[model samples]
Target: MKEDSFLKNSVLLTASNITTGILGFIFSIYLSKLIGPVGIGLYGLVMPIYNLFICLMTAGIIAAISKVSAIYKVKRQYNNISKTIKSVASFNVIWSIAIGIMVFFLAPYISKYGIHDMRTVNAIRITCPAMVFIALSNILKGYFFGVSKIVVPSFIDILEKAMRIITITLLIIFFKANSITALVTLAYLSLAIGELQSLILLFIYYKNLSKKTPSSADKPERASQLLFNVLIIALPLCINGFLGNLFGTASTLLVPRRLASAGFDASTALGMIGKFTGMALTIVTFPMIVIMSINSLIVPDLSETISRRDYYNASLRIKKVMKIAFLLGLATTVVCNLIPTSLGQMFYSRDDLGAYIKIASLSAPIFFTSSTMFGILNGLNKQSIILRNSLIVSAIEIVCLYIFIGIPGVNIMGYGITLFISSSISLFINLREVQKHIYLNLSKSNIIIFTLLSILIFMILRGLTTNILNNFITIRNIALILITFSIFIILSFFGIEED
Candidate 1:
């Protein structure tokens, strides 16, 4: 592949990712308003379990598909690529049915033991259809991404979001007159609709593929060996994903349980969890859209470099992505922290929720860094390393959330503390891994000077400016964001690019 071709592919993938991020972020605002904090908490509590189950059902086949597809495209083996897709898709279909059956029987148990809400049981049952849709959508997405066709996925993303917004908005109005059972049912229905729309768009795009077979240069190497190879790679990835999802779901279940043990009423405990854990984290998580976009674009390129044993190029790509990610993360953290309340009020008009936003602001950089690092590790076939690191952090977080919530006076803030500590630990592990593969070639003088300047600026403009900005919330917050970003960009101008 020529440099220009790679650049074009990267640009499309990145743009699609950015579009997904923006649309997904805006959609959250609607969701926050739809259910309020308490409702958001209920949804959050149920979602972790759903996501955990989904990850288990999918078995990390999505990453395996992308990895195998990249190899096949590089080798120009068109026939085997088709076989690989059919095999993975078949595997996904089988598990989807199996999991759906399991969830059908377990819904009552989940509702009774998990959140004690019958409405959530109905929601769990309604969400069963997403299993099949998500499995197909993810597998196809991996194949398209591997083959360097991102526009279809991008378009499907926008379509899915549109369906979600429309479905949820109409359903919110209709469900208002019904029970909580009706509301949760509507939410689940909207999720299934989005997944179906995405899968349909992908299927349509895939149908056009027979007209354009792979060129001679796109033929793949040994087909028989590739399946086993990809399966080997996918095993640890599956475990990593399952553990990660389980950690999240466990935290959700444990936090509220702990809160109740600390003497809060059921509603108050749920409300506090919903406010801090639900609203703040969900809204701030928009940056994930950006990170994921870049990750998708990077994976094929990373795999290509590794396959050819171009360690230098792989190191350069990793460094460049990390440096840029750090800058973006720092900028977002400063901006969000400075005006958390204003941003929260822009959507959900709740001061307490806004406070939770501020508490979570510092976590942006940690999450961004950790996510990208893991992506790089996955691309480099360092799957076991990622699994170990993730498991460590997940264990720490679960214990912290569980023990902290059992304390006498800890409330919703305990959740924030757990996230902060866990993310920070994960970031350290990722940084250590990055250093093992890529050396940071910066001069000590330049690094120290920039570090000092940033800290000084942050310290000088800390509380007073934010207090003053609160008086003129809208304009002042925007001004602060622009000014901070401009300064950061100016400082970054002096940094050297990774070779």
Candidate 2:
């Protein structure tokens, strides 16, 4: 892809993510209010299982498709590209069907034994069919990413999210879902509607592309060979994803239990976990939508660069991306710290949202850095090292939660501390490994000094503004956000520059 194409695609994807993030944020706030903390807790409980199944069904085919398709496009092997997609799609369909069946049969046991909530059984079962649609949508998305036709996938993403929100909102209004079981079931069912819509859109796009593009006369690879190649690239990633998500799910599920052990009853513990995960963490990680979109757009470009042995350009790209990521991360962290309570109150109408936000904000820099580094490492084909790092940190995080979360007075705050520690370790491990392949021009002293200076300035300005505004929460929060954003922009212009 040309530089202009890369930039355009990145901007488009980022814009889409921002739009979707806003919608999702609003949806979450509404859902939280409607369902309350207990409902949010139940919703959160169901998601880990949903995500694990989705990951297994897709089996890393998305990345594999993007990588393989990009290589074939560069080589002008359109027929091979077609064959690859077909093989992957076939494999994914089979896997998705099998997984769906398993989920349908095991829903009762999973809800009862795995999550310890019989209320989730219907919701889990209702979500199983969506996995088939999700599998199909992902295959097409991967193909689009591979061919550098991101517009289709970006538009489809927005459409899917919109559909889900609209469907759920309508269902809630029409059925008056007052109970947790009804609301959760409706939410899961809406997911199926959204996935189905996405599948339809992608199918149309695929058919049109197939009709327009000329078929190559070149003999295609055997089906078994194509499947073998895809598995070779995808299996390791799938294992990494499965294991990582499994551990992540365990850690989250343990939160309410640990809270209960700390002194609270089951209901109160679930509510606390709900507030922490469903409210606080959601707001803290809002900016991640942009970062993750950029990462997705860059991975294919990075793969193409590596394929051409253009290490210098790749290094330049990595440095510029990392610098921008770090600045954004630091700026967001400072802003969150400055007005955590204001933001929490503004978004969730909860007095304690601020506390959880403050604790989670400490992980901002570490989380952002680790996430960006993971994408770069994947682009560089360092899957094994990434897997190892993920496993190690996940183990440490789980251990930390087990040991600290149940301690008296520790409670959910222990999860926050563990998040910071785990992300920091992962970031350092990734940075060290990344340096082996490319020289990173990270100005550690400058970043540290700038971050501290920015934080100090934000605190002083926010304090003065709050006093001047007579502690009007809304105005104060908006003023602080605008001021901090302005400062970040100014600093970017004067201090940070692309290499």
Candidate 3:
């Protein structure tokens, strides 16, 4: 592929990320307002398990869709793409029905143990439809993404967010004095509505594609082989997904219970967890939206290049991508950490959450870099390694949370320590995985360059936020910083090319 392909893909995906991130941040902020911190915490408490369900239902299918769709399209086997889609879609529907029923039946026990909110049982039940829609929607997105058709999915994402925002806003107005169960149910309804909109858009897109006559010669082989191939390709990815998301869910389940055990009331404990996980961490994750944008484009491209045996180009691109991700992550960490208090006041008006944001801010680089490594390994078919690394990290979190968090005197801070340790250990695993593929020899020159760049960014950001606090908080300040960063990236690009 030409460099133009990369530039175009990056820009489109970045735009998608920006739109989705804005929508997500806005939704979370307002949702927090609607439910209050305690309600939000209860919501957050259930998220990990909810997201775990989502992963189980849709994890491996996403990568499989992208991989198979791209490969089939390249080979002009349109029929194969259709066949794979049909099989996956069929599997998804059946799986959702089975899982949704099971969840509905077991909702009471699950809620009591996991979130201590009997209300979440209904929320879990309401969210069941998402299992089906999410799988199909990802299949659609993966197909378009693999074939490099980004516009539709981007539009779908924005539309989904819009619908969600509108629906949630209206529901909050009508149900302001409703019970916690109603509020929780309304939250899941918002998700169901959003998924419905995206699926409709995707169905239309699928319908509009011109049909072609498929050869009988390849039909049998294509139909019969896709299920096996997709399963084979998707299994490790499924495991990686399960392990990667388990900690988040486990933490959510553990936090409220632990806090309650430490003498905090149930509502207060839930509120604290929500403020930290929902409000603070949500804001801290904004920079990672851009990092994830890069990862979305990297996977299929890496897979394509590796298939063609272009190891040198693949390695160079991986390094460039990793460096860029690291820089963005580091800058975000330093800037956010420096102005945690100001940012908290400006955004959410809570000092506790602000402090939590500052502490979690430092994990940005490791989180972003490790995510990139997961994408690389997934592209290289090293799914087992990804799963192993995730399992190790998640196990550390589970053990730490049970031992420390459940101790008689532990509080919310235990969860924070767990986050730091789990993320740090995961980063090490990612680094080791990368070393197995390519040796990154950081000589004095590389170290000097990295250190100097870090110092320059930190000094600039810190000076603005500290010495010029008032000006730094202004919209103008943000615009200027973005403009300067844009210029710097442009100049650096040209300089690198020239060298």
Q: Give each prediction's root-mean-square deviation over alpha carbons.
A: 3.0, 2.0, 3.0
Residue runs of model 3 more than 4 Å from their true location after superposition = 174-177, 210-222, 402-410, 439-448, 464-499
Top-down TM-score ranking: 2, 3, 1
For each candidate, give its TM-score against the true structure. Answer: 0.90, 0.95, 0.91
For candidate 1, write residues 101-206 as lDDT tens digits: 8998999998998767766887888778887788778878888877877777787887787678888878777766345556656877899888988898898887
Ranking by lDDT: 2, 1, 3
In model 2, which runs have C-alpha deviations exceeding 4 angstroms? Answer: 468-476, 493-499
CA lDDT of each prediction against the hidden true structure = 0.74, 0.83, 0.74
The stretch of ten residues in a row with the least summed lDDT in candidate 2 is 490-499
Q: What would the per-residue lDDT of candidate 3 be over residues 1-499, giving only the tens digit for each residue?
A: 4567877988888888889888888888777767788778767766777778778778877777888888887787777777888887887788777887787788889888766678788788777787678878888887887778888888889888877989987877887846666776798888887898889889888767535334434543455588777878888887678767876687567776677777888878778778777887887778777767777777778888888888777777777776666666666666566667666666675666667777767777667666688777778778888888888888888888766666665566666677777877887787677768755542335435654775676677566645554655646346544744463455334213111
C-alpha-based local distance difference test score of model 1: 0.74
What is candidate 3's TM-score against the reference? 0.91
